[model samples]
Target: MSMLSVLTSFAKRDFALAYRQRAELMQPLMFFVMVITLFPLAIGPSPEILQRVSGAVVWVAAILSLLLGMERMFRDDFMDGTLEQYTLSTTPLYAIVLVKVAVHWVVHIVPLLVLSPLLALFLNMSLPMYVALIATLLLGTPVISLIGAIGVALTVGLQRSGVLVALLLIPLFIPLLIFATSAIDSASLQLPYGFQLGIMAALALFTLAAAPAAIAYSLRVSQN
Candidate 1:
Protein backbone atom coordinates (compact mmCIF):
# COMPACT_ATOMS: atom_id res chain seq x y z
CA MET A 1 0.00 0.00 0.00
CA SER A 2 1.04 3.58 -0.56
CA MET A 3 2.32 5.50 2.48
CA LEU A 4 -0.68 7.82 2.34
CA SER A 5 -3.03 4.86 2.23
CA VAL A 6 -1.28 3.22 5.15
CA LEU A 7 -1.39 6.37 7.27
CA THR A 8 -5.02 7.00 6.44
CA SER A 9 -5.85 3.41 7.38
CA PHE A 10 -4.10 3.78 10.73
CA ALA A 11 -5.75 7.12 11.41
CA LYS A 12 -9.18 5.69 10.72
CA ARG A 13 -8.59 2.73 12.99
CA ASP A 14 -7.48 4.97 15.82
CA PHE A 15 -10.40 7.33 15.39
CA ALA A 16 -12.79 4.38 15.42
CA LEU A 17 -11.23 3.01 18.56
CA ALA A 18 -11.36 6.42 20.18
CA TYR A 19 -15.01 6.76 19.29
CA ARG A 20 -15.82 3.43 20.91
CA GLN A 21 -13.97 4.40 24.09
CA ARG A 22 -15.03 8.03 24.08
CA ALA A 23 -15.71 8.13 27.77
CA GLU A 24 -12.06 7.39 28.43
CA LEU A 25 -11.15 9.82 25.65
CA MET A 26 -13.07 12.66 27.27
CA GLN A 27 -11.31 12.36 30.62
CA PRO A 28 -8.49 14.75 29.75
CA LEU A 29 -10.83 17.44 28.46
CA MET A 30 -13.06 17.13 31.51
CA PHE A 31 -10.03 17.41 33.76
CA PHE A 32 -8.89 20.49 31.84
CA VAL A 33 -12.24 22.24 32.31
CA MET A 34 -12.49 21.25 35.96
CA VAL A 35 -9.00 22.52 36.73
CA ILE A 36 -9.64 25.82 35.00
CA THR A 37 -13.01 26.15 36.73
CA LEU A 38 -11.59 25.59 40.21
CA PHE A 39 -8.98 28.32 39.83
CA PRO A 40 -11.48 31.19 40.22
CA LEU A 41 -13.09 29.63 43.29
CA ALA A 42 -9.74 29.06 44.96
CA ILE A 43 -8.29 32.47 44.17
CA GLY A 44 -11.48 34.55 44.41
CA PRO A 45 -13.43 36.15 41.54
CA SER A 46 -11.47 39.34 40.98
CA PRO A 47 -11.11 39.91 37.25
CA GLU A 48 -7.72 41.46 37.78
CA ILE A 49 -6.40 38.38 39.55
CA LEU A 50 -7.96 35.98 37.10
CA GLN A 51 -6.69 37.91 34.10
CA ARG A 52 -3.25 38.25 35.63
CA VAL A 53 -2.82 34.52 36.30
CA SER A 54 -5.13 33.16 33.59
CA GLY A 55 -2.37 32.31 31.15
CA ALA A 56 -0.34 30.36 33.68
CA VAL A 57 -3.39 28.59 35.05
CA VAL A 58 -4.71 27.55 31.64
CA TRP A 59 -1.37 26.37 30.28
CA VAL A 60 -0.56 24.41 33.42
CA ALA A 61 -3.94 22.72 33.39
CA ALA A 62 -3.54 21.85 29.70
CA ILE A 63 -0.19 20.19 30.32
CA LEU A 64 -1.54 18.16 33.20
CA SER A 65 -4.60 17.09 31.21
CA LEU A 66 -2.51 15.98 28.26
CA LEU A 67 -0.27 13.98 30.57
CA LEU A 68 -3.31 12.28 32.06
CA GLY A 69 -4.00 10.75 28.68
CA MET A 70 -0.46 10.15 27.56
CA GLU A 71 -0.01 6.71 29.11
CA ARG A 72 -2.48 4.98 26.83
CA MET A 73 -0.98 6.32 23.61
CA PHE A 74 0.83 3.07 22.87
CA ARG A 75 -0.45 0.73 25.59
CA ASP A 76 -3.20 -0.92 23.60
CA ASP A 77 -1.03 -1.44 20.54
CA PHE A 78 1.76 -2.85 22.61
CA MET A 79 -0.52 -5.24 24.46
CA ASP A 80 -2.24 -6.44 21.28
CA GLY A 81 1.04 -7.01 19.40
CA THR A 82 0.31 -4.33 16.80
CA LEU A 83 3.48 -2.53 17.72
CA GLU A 84 5.51 -5.66 17.06
CA GLN A 85 3.84 -6.03 13.69
CA TYR A 86 4.71 -2.43 12.86
CA THR A 87 8.33 -3.08 13.73
CA LEU A 88 8.35 -6.00 11.32
CA SER A 89 6.38 -4.33 8.55
CA THR A 90 7.77 -2.87 5.35
CA THR A 91 6.27 0.52 6.23
CA PRO A 92 8.51 2.59 8.47
CA LEU A 93 7.78 2.60 12.18
CA TYR A 94 8.24 6.33 12.42
CA ALA A 95 5.37 6.92 10.01
CA ILE A 96 3.08 4.77 12.14
CA VAL A 97 4.24 6.55 15.28
CA LEU A 98 3.57 9.92 13.71
CA VAL A 99 0.03 8.97 12.74
CA LYS A 100 -0.70 7.61 16.21
CA VAL A 101 0.46 10.78 17.91
CA ALA A 102 -1.43 12.98 15.45
CA VAL A 103 -4.63 11.02 16.01
CA HIS A 104 -4.21 11.15 19.77
CA TRP A 105 -3.66 14.89 19.67
CA VAL A 106 -6.71 15.42 17.49
CA VAL A 107 -8.97 13.15 19.50
CA HIS A 108 -7.94 14.71 22.81
CA ILE A 109 -6.96 18.32 22.23
CA VAL A 110 -9.65 19.42 19.78
CA PRO A 111 -12.29 19.36 22.50
CA LEU A 112 -10.11 21.49 24.74
CA LEU A 113 -9.65 23.98 21.92
CA VAL A 114 -13.39 24.13 21.31
CA LEU A 115 -14.13 24.64 24.99
CA SER A 116 -11.38 27.25 25.43
CA PRO A 117 -13.54 30.26 24.58
CA LEU A 118 -15.91 29.64 27.48
CA LEU A 119 -12.99 28.91 29.79
CA ALA A 120 -11.23 32.08 28.70
CA LEU A 121 -14.37 34.10 29.36
CA PHE A 122 -14.74 32.51 32.78
CA LEU A 123 -11.20 33.63 33.58
CA ASN A 124 -11.96 37.14 32.32
CA MET A 125 -9.25 37.02 29.68
CA SER A 126 -9.30 40.01 27.35
CA LEU A 127 -9.74 39.44 23.62
CA PRO A 128 -6.08 39.97 22.85
CA MET A 129 -4.97 37.49 25.48
CA TYR A 130 -7.59 34.98 24.35
CA VAL A 131 -6.32 35.14 20.77
CA ALA A 132 -2.76 34.72 21.98
CA LEU A 133 -3.85 31.76 24.14
CA ILE A 134 -5.34 30.02 21.11
CA ALA A 135 -2.27 30.73 18.99
CA THR A 136 0.08 29.38 21.63
CA LEU A 137 -2.05 26.27 22.17
CA LEU A 138 -2.21 25.55 18.44
CA LEU A 139 1.55 25.69 18.18
CA GLY A 140 2.51 24.21 21.54
CA THR A 141 0.07 21.34 22.20
CA PRO A 142 1.35 19.30 19.23
CA VAL A 143 4.83 19.57 20.61
CA ILE A 144 3.43 18.31 23.91
CA SER A 145 1.90 15.29 22.17
CA LEU A 146 4.97 14.58 20.04
CA ILE A 147 7.41 14.72 22.93
CA GLY A 148 5.07 12.96 25.31
CA ALA A 149 4.83 10.11 22.82
CA ILE A 150 8.48 9.29 23.31
CA GLY A 151 8.02 8.94 27.05
CA VAL A 152 4.92 6.84 26.55
CA ALA A 153 6.70 4.63 24.06
CA LEU A 154 9.50 4.03 26.54
CA THR A 155 7.12 3.03 29.30
CA VAL A 156 4.40 1.19 27.35
CA GLY A 157 5.63 -2.11 28.71
CA LEU A 158 5.20 -0.99 32.30
CA GLN A 159 1.96 -1.74 34.11
CA ARG A 160 1.89 1.65 35.87
CA SER A 161 3.42 4.26 33.59
CA GLY A 162 1.19 7.27 34.09
CA VAL A 163 3.33 8.78 36.79
CA LEU A 164 6.51 7.75 35.01
CA VAL A 165 5.37 9.41 31.80
CA ALA A 166 4.54 12.58 33.72
CA LEU A 167 7.90 12.55 35.48
CA LEU A 168 9.81 12.06 32.26
CA LEU A 169 7.89 14.58 30.17
CA ILE A 170 6.81 17.40 32.49
CA PRO A 171 10.25 19.01 32.70
CA LEU A 172 10.47 19.09 28.92
CA PHE A 173 7.03 20.74 28.88
CA ILE A 174 8.07 23.55 31.24
CA PRO A 175 9.83 25.54 28.52
CA LEU A 176 6.75 25.32 26.31
CA LEU A 177 4.53 26.39 29.22
CA ILE A 178 6.76 29.40 29.86
CA PHE A 179 6.80 30.51 26.22
CA ALA A 180 3.03 30.08 25.86
CA THR A 181 2.14 31.92 29.08
CA SER A 182 4.58 34.71 28.21
CA ALA A 183 2.81 35.25 24.90
CA ILE A 184 -0.52 35.53 26.68
CA ASP A 185 0.96 37.88 29.25
CA SER A 186 2.31 40.11 26.49
CA ALA A 187 -1.10 40.25 24.89
CA SER A 188 -2.61 41.21 28.24
CA LEU A 189 -0.23 44.19 28.37
CA GLN A 190 -1.24 45.24 24.84
CA LEU A 191 2.30 44.49 23.67
CA PRO A 192 3.43 42.37 20.73
CA TYR A 193 3.97 38.66 21.43
CA GLY A 194 5.36 37.55 18.13
CA PHE A 195 8.65 36.47 19.71
CA GLN A 196 7.08 34.06 22.20
CA LEU A 197 4.78 32.67 19.54
CA GLY A 198 7.76 32.34 17.23
CA ILE A 199 9.64 30.30 19.82
CA MET A 200 6.65 27.99 20.25
CA ALA A 201 6.35 27.57 16.49
CA ALA A 202 10.03 26.70 16.34
CA LEU A 203 9.65 24.14 19.10
CA ALA A 204 6.67 22.60 17.34
CA LEU A 205 8.56 22.35 14.07
CA PHE A 206 11.61 20.86 15.73
CA THR A 207 9.58 18.22 17.55
CA LEU A 208 7.50 17.43 14.47
CA ALA A 209 10.72 16.76 12.60
CA ALA A 210 12.50 14.77 15.30
CA ALA A 211 10.03 13.08 17.67
CA PRO A 212 8.63 10.38 15.39
CA ALA A 213 11.96 8.71 14.85
CA ALA A 214 12.77 8.86 18.57
CA ILE A 215 9.41 7.35 19.42
CA ALA A 216 9.83 4.60 16.87
CA TYR A 217 13.18 3.66 18.37
CA SER A 218 11.71 3.64 21.86
CA LEU A 219 8.87 1.40 20.69
CA ARG A 220 11.27 -1.02 19.07
CA VAL A 221 13.31 -1.17 22.28
CA SER A 222 10.22 -1.73 24.39
CA GLN A 223 8.98 -4.50 22.12
CA ASN A 224 12.24 -6.40 22.37
Candidate 2:
Protein backbone atom coordinates (compact mmCIF):
# COMPACT_ATOMS: atom_id res chain seq x y z
CA MET A 1 0.00 0.00 0.00
CA SER A 2 1.02 3.58 -0.52
CA MET A 3 2.13 5.78 2.38
CA LEU A 4 -0.98 7.89 2.13
CA SER A 5 -3.15 4.79 2.19
CA VAL A 6 -1.50 3.50 5.35
CA LEU A 7 -1.91 6.86 7.07
CA THR A 8 -5.56 6.96 6.02
CA SER A 9 -6.09 3.52 7.47
CA PHE A 10 -4.46 4.49 10.73
CA ALA A 11 -6.43 7.71 10.93
CA LYS A 12 -9.69 5.81 10.50
CA ARG A 13 -8.84 3.33 13.21
CA ASP A 14 -7.81 6.10 15.60
CA PHE A 15 -10.98 8.10 15.14
CA ALA A 16 -13.14 4.99 15.26
CA LEU A 17 -11.73 4.07 18.63
CA ALA A 18 -12.24 7.64 19.84
CA TYR A 19 -15.90 7.46 18.77
CA ARG A 20 -16.45 4.19 20.55
CA GLN A 21 -15.00 5.71 23.69
CA ARG A 22 -16.83 9.00 23.52
CA ALA A 23 -17.44 9.46 27.22
CA GLU A 24 -13.84 8.80 28.06
CA LEU A 25 -12.88 11.24 25.34
CA MET A 26 -15.19 13.96 26.62
CA GLN A 27 -13.57 13.83 30.03
CA PRO A 28 -10.83 16.24 28.98
CA LEU A 29 -13.20 18.87 27.59
CA MET A 30 -15.39 18.58 30.62
CA PHE A 31 -12.35 18.92 32.81
CA PHE A 32 -11.29 22.11 31.04
CA VAL A 33 -14.69 23.70 31.60
CA MET A 34 -14.88 22.56 35.17
CA VAL A 35 -11.39 23.81 35.95
CA ILE A 36 -12.04 27.21 34.40
CA THR A 37 -15.24 27.60 36.39
CA LEU A 38 -13.41 26.79 39.59
CA PHE A 39 -10.89 29.56 38.98
CA PRO A 40 -13.39 32.37 39.50
CA LEU A 41 -14.66 30.78 42.66
CA ALA A 42 -11.25 30.24 44.17
CA ILE A 43 -9.99 33.69 43.30
CA GLY A 44 -13.06 35.49 44.70
CA PRO A 45 -15.83 37.30 42.86
CA SER A 46 -13.81 40.35 41.89
CA PRO A 47 -13.84 40.67 38.13
CA GLU A 48 -10.61 42.65 38.14
CA ILE A 49 -8.79 39.90 39.96
CA LEU A 50 -10.15 37.33 37.58
CA GLN A 51 -9.21 39.42 34.58
CA ARG A 52 -5.71 39.87 35.86
CA VAL A 53 -5.23 36.13 35.99
CA SER A 54 -7.32 34.81 33.14
CA GLY A 55 -4.53 34.33 30.61
CA ALA A 56 -2.59 31.99 32.86
CA VAL A 57 -5.81 30.31 33.87
CA VAL A 58 -6.74 29.48 30.29
CA TRP A 59 -3.25 28.22 29.54
CA VAL A 60 -3.14 26.02 32.64
CA ALA A 61 -6.56 24.65 31.88
CA ALA A 62 -5.37 23.80 28.38
CA ILE A 63 -2.32 21.94 29.67
CA LEU A 64 -4.46 19.97 32.09
CA SER A 65 -6.96 19.17 29.37
CA LEU A 66 -4.21 17.81 27.14
CA LEU A 67 -2.90 15.71 30.02
CA LEU A 68 -6.34 14.25 30.59
CA GLY A 69 -6.78 13.52 26.90
CA MET A 70 -3.43 11.94 26.03
CA GLU A 71 -3.16 8.77 28.11
CA ARG A 72 -5.25 6.48 25.97
CA MET A 73 -3.89 7.76 22.67
CA PHE A 74 -0.94 5.42 22.48
CA ARG A 75 -1.75 3.09 25.34
CA ASP A 76 -4.76 1.41 23.76
CA ASP A 77 -3.08 0.62 20.50
CA PHE A 78 0.06 -0.69 22.15
CA MET A 79 -1.89 -3.08 24.36
CA ASP A 80 -4.22 -4.31 21.64
CA GLY A 81 -1.66 -5.35 19.04
CA THR A 82 -2.49 -2.60 16.55
CA LEU A 83 0.69 -0.72 17.31
CA GLU A 84 2.72 -3.88 16.96
CA GLN A 85 1.27 -4.48 13.56
CA TYR A 86 2.03 -0.93 12.52
CA THR A 87 5.60 -1.29 13.64
CA LEU A 88 5.92 -4.49 11.68
CA SER A 89 4.25 -3.09 8.58
CA THR A 90 5.99 -1.69 5.52
CA THR A 91 4.72 1.79 6.32
CA PRO A 92 7.19 4.04 8.11
CA LEU A 93 6.54 4.12 11.83
CA TYR A 94 7.34 7.82 11.99
CA ALA A 95 4.72 8.51 9.33
CA ILE A 96 2.20 6.47 11.26
CA VAL A 97 3.10 8.41 14.41
CA LEU A 98 2.69 11.67 12.55
CA VAL A 99 -0.78 10.69 11.38
CA LYS A 100 -1.84 9.62 14.84
CA VAL A 101 -0.46 12.84 16.27
CA ALA A 102 -2.41 14.89 13.72
CA VAL A 103 -5.62 13.03 14.51
CA HIS A 104 -5.03 13.31 18.24
CA TRP A 105 -4.46 17.05 17.96
CA VAL A 106 -7.70 17.38 16.00
CA VAL A 107 -9.75 15.50 18.56
CA HIS A 108 -8.10 16.85 21.70
CA ILE A 109 -6.35 20.19 21.24
CA VAL A 110 -8.66 21.76 18.67
CA PRO A 111 -11.59 21.83 21.07
CA LEU A 112 -9.47 23.49 23.72
CA LEU A 113 -8.51 26.22 21.24
CA VAL A 114 -12.13 26.59 20.13
CA LEU A 115 -13.54 26.80 23.63
CA SER A 116 -10.78 29.04 25.00
CA PRO A 117 -12.64 32.26 24.36
CA LEU A 118 -15.58 31.01 26.37
CA LEU A 119 -13.27 29.96 29.17
CA ALA A 120 -11.48 33.28 28.99
CA LEU A 121 -14.72 35.19 29.56
CA PHE A 122 -15.34 33.30 32.78
CA LEU A 123 -11.90 34.23 34.04
CA ASN A 124 -12.63 37.87 33.14
CA MET A 125 -10.27 38.10 30.22
CA SER A 126 -10.36 41.45 28.44
CA LEU A 127 -11.99 41.62 25.01
CA PRO A 128 -8.98 43.23 23.36
CA MET A 129 -6.71 40.28 24.00
CA TYR A 130 -8.97 37.74 22.31
CA VAL A 131 -7.32 37.82 18.92
CA ALA A 132 -3.85 37.40 20.39
CA LEU A 133 -5.04 34.48 22.48
CA ILE A 134 -6.59 32.78 19.49
CA ALA A 135 -3.60 33.49 17.30
CA THR A 136 -1.23 32.09 19.90
CA LEU A 137 -3.35 28.99 20.13
CA LEU A 138 -3.49 28.56 16.38
CA LEU A 139 0.24 29.01 15.89
CA GLY A 140 1.39 27.22 19.05
CA THR A 141 -1.00 24.40 19.88
CA PRO A 142 0.30 21.84 17.42
CA VAL A 143 3.58 21.84 19.32
CA ILE A 144 1.68 21.00 22.47
CA SER A 145 -0.02 18.13 20.68
CA LEU A 146 3.25 16.87 19.21
CA ILE A 147 5.04 17.06 22.55
CA GLY A 148 2.08 15.21 24.01
CA ALA A 149 2.51 12.41 21.48
CA ILE A 150 6.10 11.96 22.66
CA GLY A 151 4.89 11.72 26.26
CA VAL A 152 2.27 9.19 25.29
CA ALA A 153 4.79 7.10 23.38
CA LEU A 154 7.20 7.10 26.29
CA THR A 155 4.75 6.25 29.01
CA VAL A 156 2.19 4.12 27.15
CA GLY A 157 2.64 0.89 29.03
CA LEU A 158 3.68 2.06 32.45
CA GLN A 159 1.48 1.80 35.51
CA ARG A 160 1.06 5.19 37.24
CA SER A 161 3.13 7.01 34.63
CA GLY A 162 0.95 10.08 34.28
CA VAL A 163 2.99 11.94 36.84
CA LEU A 164 6.12 10.91 35.08
CA VAL A 165 4.75 12.11 31.79
CA ALA A 166 3.83 15.46 33.30
CA LEU A 167 7.26 15.80 34.76
CA LEU A 168 8.84 15.02 31.43
CA LEU A 169 6.68 17.49 29.57
CA ILE A 170 6.38 20.50 31.87
CA PRO A 171 9.93 21.75 31.35
CA LEU A 172 9.61 21.31 27.63
CA PHE A 173 6.40 23.31 27.80
CA ILE A 174 7.91 26.27 29.65
CA PRO A 175 8.98 28.05 26.45
CA LEU A 176 5.48 27.57 25.08
CA LEU A 177 3.94 28.91 28.25
CA ILE A 178 6.28 31.90 28.23
CA PHE A 179 5.68 32.88 24.61
CA ALA A 180 1.97 32.11 24.74
CA THR A 181 1.45 34.24 27.82
CA SER A 182 3.70 36.93 26.37
CA ALA A 183 1.59 37.24 23.26
CA ILE A 184 -1.57 37.84 25.23
CA ASP A 185 0.28 40.16 27.57
CA SER A 186 1.52 42.15 24.61
CA ALA A 187 -1.99 42.61 23.32
CA SER A 188 -3.09 43.74 26.76
CA LEU A 189 -0.25 46.24 26.88
CA GLN A 190 -0.96 47.40 23.33
CA LEU A 191 2.64 46.53 22.50
CA PRO A 192 3.61 44.45 19.47
CA TYR A 193 2.22 40.91 19.64
CA GLY A 194 3.43 39.36 16.42
CA PHE A 195 6.97 38.83 17.70
CA GLN A 196 5.70 36.44 20.36
CA LEU A 197 3.40 34.87 17.83
CA GLY A 198 6.42 34.32 15.61
CA ILE A 199 8.28 32.57 18.42
CA MET A 200 5.35 30.21 18.88
CA ALA A 201 5.27 29.60 15.14
CA ALA A 202 8.93 28.63 15.23
CA LEU A 203 8.38 26.20 18.08
CA ALA A 204 5.43 24.62 16.28
CA LEU A 205 7.57 24.17 13.20
CA PHE A 206 10.37 22.57 15.19
CA THR A 207 7.98 20.18 16.90
CA LEU A 208 6.44 19.17 13.59
CA ALA A 209 9.87 18.34 12.24
CA ALA A 210 11.13 16.52 15.33
CA ALA A 211 8.20 14.77 17.05
CA PRO A 212 7.56 12.06 14.47
CA ALA A 213 11.17 11.04 14.37
CA ALA A 214 11.37 10.98 18.16
CA ILE A 215 8.23 8.85 18.37
CA ALA A 216 9.62 6.47 15.77
CA TYR A 217 12.88 6.07 17.64
CA SER A 218 11.10 5.50 20.94
CA LEU A 219 8.87 2.84 19.42
CA ARG A 220 11.88 1.07 17.95
CA VAL A 221 13.67 1.12 21.28
CA SER A 222 10.55 -0.14 23.07
CA GLN A 223 10.02 -2.92 20.54
CA ASN A 224 13.57 -4.11 21.02
TM-score: which candidate is best? 1
After superposing all C-alphas onto the true structure, candidate 2 shows an RMSD in angstroms of: 1.4
Quote the lDDT for 67 in model 2: 80
Tens digits of per-residue lDDT for model 2 on 1-224?
67788689889988897888888888999998998999899889898787777777778788878887777778877888888988888888899999988888888877777787778778777766778878877777788888888887877768877888888987888898888888888777788987888889888998999999998787666656
Stretches > 4 Å off in candidate 2: none
* Cα RMSD for candidates in order: 0.7, 1.4
For candidate 1, the 10 contiguous residues with the lowest summed lDDT are 82-91
The all-Cα superposition gives candidate 1 an RMSD in Å to the true structure of 0.7
lDDT of 1 by residue, 77-150 (tens): 89998888889988899999999999999998899999999999999999999999999999999999999999
The list of candidate 1 runs beyond 4 A from truth reads none
Where does candidate 2 clash, by residue pair? none
Query: What local distance difference test score does each model get?
Result: 0.94, 0.82
Native-to-model Cα distance after best TM-score fit, residue 183 in candidate 1, in Å: 0.4
